[model samples]
Target: MKSTHVLILLGLLAACKSQPKEKETEAPANAPKAEPIACYQYATAADTITLKLVNMGGTVGGALIYKLKEKDMNAGTIKGTLRGDILLADYTFKSEGTQSTRQVAFKKTGNAFIEGYGETTNVNGVEQFKNADSIVYSSSMKLEEIPCK
Candidate 1:
């Protein structure tokens, strides 16, 4: 009788045991996808600026092309860290046949990136400007987002 009771108790305990959870092998089919990268361009009489950036959260990284007549035409890369609505990055490019680097910032409004206020970067004794504004975009020469093909 005692042996039978012990076996019954063991059987009851085993029946009440919880099963191990199964791990997820893959993401759900209905999971949302990430946003695609965006491209922007700014044109003026003196310069033309183009940027192809991918924003992950608030951080930005992409290609930047800046060209200014008699100043510099640079095709460099940008790695931006966000502060407020501004994306600040160090721009390194080949300017006037010479390589140089500088600090540049942009402010995002809607789908546009207006100049946030660039001081000056010395690139072989030359300076590059896409707009006349010392700290922000003026009435003209704004950086607007362009559709990618």
Candidate 2:
């Protein structure tokens, strides 16, 4: 496996095994979002997401698997993937569907971790998804001091 993948795996592990952070005292007025460091880059080791969609106020749970790549540090950037089959929920379709997203994760200052947001839309000739037809999302799952096992 590539070193980037290794780093990502370690990062996931770190997120999983770390302790909850207590509210620390406020930093100096000039403190930056992240400690300045060289750019951090990582490739997908393995990634998966579970999402719940509410159409017409009805909730449906769906899951997606992703190949996540990220460049970490303050305002980091991530480029990963989303697929149609993985994103498709239990919707009646007369025709087909398509998944569309680009470079999912991008770093923003003051955010605690790697964050990403994307959407999925399915083409259905039968009926248009009412109430909510699309998914929009983001996540801040940054872990610190990860050493891959």
Each model's TM-score, in the order given? 0.57, 0.19
What C-alpha lDDT does candidate 1 achieve relative to the native structure? 0.72
User: Model 2, range 51-84, lDDT digits (tens) per residue?
Assistant: 2122222222222223344521122122222232
Taken over the whole model, the C-alpha lDDT of each candidate is 0.72, 0.33
Error of 2 at 108 (Å): 1.6
**Colliding pairs, model 1:** 117-135
lDDT of 1 at 42: 88
The TM-score between candidate 2 and the true structure equals 0.19
Model 2 lDDT, full chain set: 0.33
Cα lDDT, model 1, residue 130: 44
Tens-digit lDDT track for model 1 on 1-149? 99999999999999999999899877677653334468889888888989887665556677888786776577998866767666777677776587766667777788888765645655565454444245664435567889964
Among all windows of 10 consecutive residues in model 2, the one with the lowest summed lDDT is 72-81
